[model samples]
Target: MNLLSFWIAHRADMLGAIAQHLTLTLVATIAAIAIAVPLGIVATRRPRLGTALLTFANIAQTVPSLAMFGFLVALPLLGGVGARSALLVLILYALLPIMRNTVAGIQGIDRAARDAGVALGMTPQQLLLQVELPLAMPTMVAGVRVAAVVGVGAATIAAAIGAGGLGDYIFRGLSMTEPTLILAGAVPAALLALAVDASLGWLERAMTPGAARSRRVTTRAMTVGGVVLLLIVMGGYAVSGRWGSRVIVGSKNFSEQVILGELLAQVIERTTDLSVERRLNLGGTFISDQALQSGAIDAYVEYTGTALTAIFHQPVLRDHVDVLERVTAAYAATGRAVLSPLGFNNTFAILIRAADAQRLNLTTISDAAPHTPGWKAAFGYEFLEREDGYKGLVRTYGLRFAGTPHVMDLTLSYRALAGGSVDLIAGEATSGLIKGLDLYMLEDDRRYFPPYHAIPVVRTETLAAHPELRTAIERLAGRISEEAMRQMNYDVDVSRRDVTVVAREFLDTVLQSP
Candidate 1:
């Protein structure tokens, strides 16, 4: 199905997502305007301060929004992750354009006009409010326009940190390899940007004094209409209680994660009286973990390897049972429970194109480590940057490569490796799409990578409220063997099957049989 059709099919979700996307953008834009305009005004008055403020704004823009979101997630003062961190990041992003524009707009005003105001006995404040600001409205609006558009686009990435938006569909679609799902998100987002830009443009034009009075009135009417429309959207969401659900399941951006998340939601809905709210297809492992901690998500599936390496910064292991026990014990101390592991390991391994592996005689991580200098290494965003990820592993192994390790989106990492563009990929899982690309998973003889047994991680509060949810989910835990996970992964990643279908089938087979 095309994206429009997918959105139509999932209209309820699409609407909820739209509401969330707009909320983040609007809040961030208003905050940005409030702060940026004053900062811009001050900067205009003091040229030295303006340069420093502009430099700071530029620097803030340099930090990728995703990285900024991650940084916030790690901050203790930020108190874990969720919408607040996401909002802070979005505001940071919006500031640069808004601030710069405000300064430019205020400064861009005609010098003669300012002189006229002064000659007419207007005070500095009066000159600014009546002459400068009025003349600068169009420029300021343009800046806000840029910030709003950028904010909307950046807000999509907020899904990575459990900040709901259209990004949920895009990330989920990427995980499931379904273009339709992505379209469901992308199209609406594009429409939203256009709508916002046009709305703001009209407002700016209306605010321009001496413009046709009729045009001004029309612009005012349009602005009022936009506000009313937003209110209606919010009212609808409130009535639906999208924010008040008792259970919210979230997942990292990957097919297996999505499937496991759906399985958890489905099982909970079937076996428990609590309502199920799926917030699946969130971003990286850290983001999802923070989401659970911050009360954005009640529970979600995670791998033991991630909990050990990414969360705990421990060594990866070969022994699955021992690893699970250690991780469970550790997590339990944090008021989180690692439920019974589903007997399978989806640990990270190096993947190279079949041809490249043969050429290099690389059968293991150690073998490939020395030769990494010979080929460019491409990694998924999280895997490349995390301390427990490629940086740590490469340092620990004492391996040097000639080429700089490059980071790509996780969804594209396999394709890049398979196409021979990247010689080595650091964090390949058994269910990764690279399996079908004639690539081989290098052996981790020293076992630097941890066993990634799939399991559900839940806050202690959630467990206390829904004790049976764990057992119900555990029913399908070990049912998926390593080979089964590989095949199921292929079905979604390679064969292009719907994740929901695959998850439902797995659940039916495991729960309905015997």
Candidate 2:
């Protein structure tokens, strides 16, 4: 579809994302202003406190956005996969600029201006309120403008943890290898950032001592009213459609997981009265698991092999039954249950370009091992760290490459290999990109990897609360064959079909009687 047509079709989604993006940015910026402005004011008095506050803010600025998120998600109360944790991260990132500008704006004021206020019989509090703040307003606002713009960009990362925003579109497009989808998210985000910068820039200029502006609109009451209006918008967005009979279905950040997530949501909607709230694209295995266990998400699909090795941290087993059983028991111990397998074993496939495979006559992992000494490899973040991933595979094959594999997003790794950016990637066994991108999966001659049968993992308590959820979930047991899954993936990844259309068509087949 053309860009305009895509926007027309997905307008609701786009608008929703824009609202979420605005809410996240506005809320975080406001909160930062409230905290930093006071701190800035006090810093003008106590130089020691100012030094400490600046030092702490500078340290926070040094932490990587994604790394900070991962660290925060593991903490209690203030952490989780939502706006709660995302807000904290954004707030920390915004603190440095706002506070620094506050200090600079106040400290940069002339000594004569302060002495004049004191000589005019004004108290310290009155001098600050009447003279100091008015003079510093423009500079302080410049700091806020910086913070809001930065927050707009950083808020995209929040989507990885299910905090809805434009980043969802960016991540979705990347996973499916669809440029149009990426632009749908990215273009709006860029525009939003510009819009925010301009709005605040105007405010900054207006607050200047000599700048001409409407006195009524710039009054304290007007400013307070504007803040209240923003808070109201944020509150309205947060609580709307969030309650009622709903099951929040979540998925990991990949095309297949999204398709599977849609499949589960569709089935639940078809079989029950419950409304399905899709929180898909919640980053990686552990994040989804944390969401499910914490009751933040009712359910999501997982794999037996991933469950055993990645979650359980146990030894990889060849027997599918043993793997599934151990995974099931382990999940039960954590108040979750593993549902019936979805009739696919999407194990790790060592992929290389098909043309290279044919030219080198590489048919198995061992065949390519001797040629790997000069090749650079790329791997997904999870694959590099998972028990059944890069290190283990290298150890098992006794293969040595030119250097350590570069970590990459799982979806992008497919295109990277096809584009010759990297010689190798660990792809899914049932990934449509294997065929679509002309990539070949080398035979795992030694059977180093375990079976990765897809299954729905859910909170046991949720099942008790909503008994029909079990019925809806069970209807999909052993229904989706590997080929069917591959086609659904191909429809999304290669054919550029929307996930809902693909999921609804597939779910129809599953619901049909024998």
Enumerate clash totals for all models, in the order shown.
5, 0
Global local distance difference test of model 1: 0.79
CA error at residue 150 for candidate 2, angstroms: 1.1
Cα lDDT tens digits for candidate 1, 1-514: 4555565666776777888888889898999899999999999999999999999999999998877877888788664566788788888898988889889888888799999999999999999998999899888888898899888899988887778788888888776667877877888898889988887787677667677785768767877887886885786466334655468888888887887788888888777776777788777787788788778898998887778777887776657777788888888888888877777778777777878678878787787777766778887877875555776677767767767777777667777877767777764465647666788888877767666778888888888987877777777766878877887888888887777788878777778876
TM-score (C-alpha, index-matched) for candidate 2 = 0.92
Tens digits of per-residue lDDT for model 2, 1-514? 5778888986766666777888899889999999999999888899999999999999998999999988887888889888888999999999999999999999988889999999999999999999898898889999999999999999998988888888988888877778988898888899989977887787787788766554445565458857865765556444433546678899998999999999999999898998777788889999998888777799999999999999989998999999999999999999998899989889899999999999999999999999999998999989888889988999999888898888988888898899988998899988988989999999999999999999999899989999899889999999888888888888899899989899999988779866
lDDT measured at residue 33 in model 1 versus the true structure, 0 to 100: 90
Clashing pairs in 1: 316-449, 316-450, 317-450, 373-401, 373-402
Off by over 4 Å in 1: 44-51, 104-132, 174-178, 235-241, 315-317, 349-411, 422-429, 432-435, 440-450
